[model samples]
Target: MRRFTRNAAVAAAAAVAALGLTVTQASATSLDTWTVTPGGSFTATATNPTLTVPAATLECASSSASGTLDTGSGNPGAGIGTITTLSFTDCSVIGIDFDVTTAGSMPLNVNGVSSVANAVDGSITNIDAHVEGTACSADFTGQVTGYYKNDTKQLVINDGNLTASNADCLGVINDDDPALYEAVYAVSGGHTITLD
Candidate 1:
């Protein structure tokens, strides 16, 4: 009876080890590599994009962005891609029609990707935009937080760490005033990217 009990215990330990091994193997599909399937270049268009400062705010009806991401494999770190161009259209700043330009701030860094189900959390850093209106001008620069959902292929720019400076309009945007930039971009050309 003692011999039989010992054999049963040994078999149980083996079974547990095998199950652990199987689980480890199945979990190997982590975000180890990222691929930009159809193409590397992608274009994104936004709806209801807006930029707000303390004094003035611009509510844009339409916006668009274009950028490229490199094919990174095996534990991708920061700087995997960059946003080459960003444009805002049909914007009104304090009742004055205007447009926002990110001049000299092109190629914004695409920092890193966080693990999420069917989606990747993306952070777009180094945001700098120049807003000019009928009688006002300001410069906004800072980083913004956003996430790219794989299911909808939408990159939503919501909360941001932005600041305003060099205000000439009046007193709406002061030097070092906190700012917020918001937009929802639908990405295209780079179909269904996987960041894992």
Candidate 2:
């Protein structure tokens, strides 16, 4: 009787294991590498703007920027990528034509990702804008908060701030001052993109 009981218990355990009930695998799938290209042209505008140069306050009329978004093999919800060939156009200061001629890249990351919504909010950081004008040229640092929509393939920058040092500007304006200015940017031109 004792041998029979032991055998029965072992058989039940074996049956449970054989049914594949011991371990479970996750059903969720993570996104791999993907690239987003602009489908059409986009624009950005500055708000609550203040430009302190030589004690002069100015506001930015508008900003035109475009770039490609790339995510190199990682989870879309929490991943890091780069924006290449990012350019700015028609950014003015104090009613003067301010042009950003130097093209550069920006570091981007996604947070609070929602697969159901098909969207991800992120930040654009470490932006080095090489700006050139008739009177002065300078390198400015930019930070922005934006979102990406999977359905529309659009990346929008709703709010942003730009800062530049007197030294970075080559002593043209604000030669000894560093100040923060408001800016807005977007990218949505008949662009093409691939998600893998």
The worst-scoring run of ten residues by lDDT in candidate 2 lies at: 24-33
My TM-score estimates for the predictions, one after another, are: 0.73, 0.48
Q: Estimate, for each residue in 1-196, the C-alpha lDDT of model 2 and write its tens digit.
A: 9999999999998998866543432113233334444322343333333344454444454444444344233325333556555444455665666665434666666654545366666677777665566676665676766666666655655545656653434455654344454444434553333444
lDDT of 1 at 135: 75
Report how far residue 110 has shifted in candidate 1, in Å: 6.2
* Model 1: lDDT of residue 22: 86
Q: Which candidate wins on TM-score?
A: 1
lDDT by residue (94-187, candidate 1, tens digit) is 6788868996434333334545566665667778888887777788887887777777888888886888888787776678889888888999
- Name the regions of candidate 1 deviating beyond 4 angstroms: 1-35, 105-117, 193-195
Local lDDT at 86 for model 2: 48
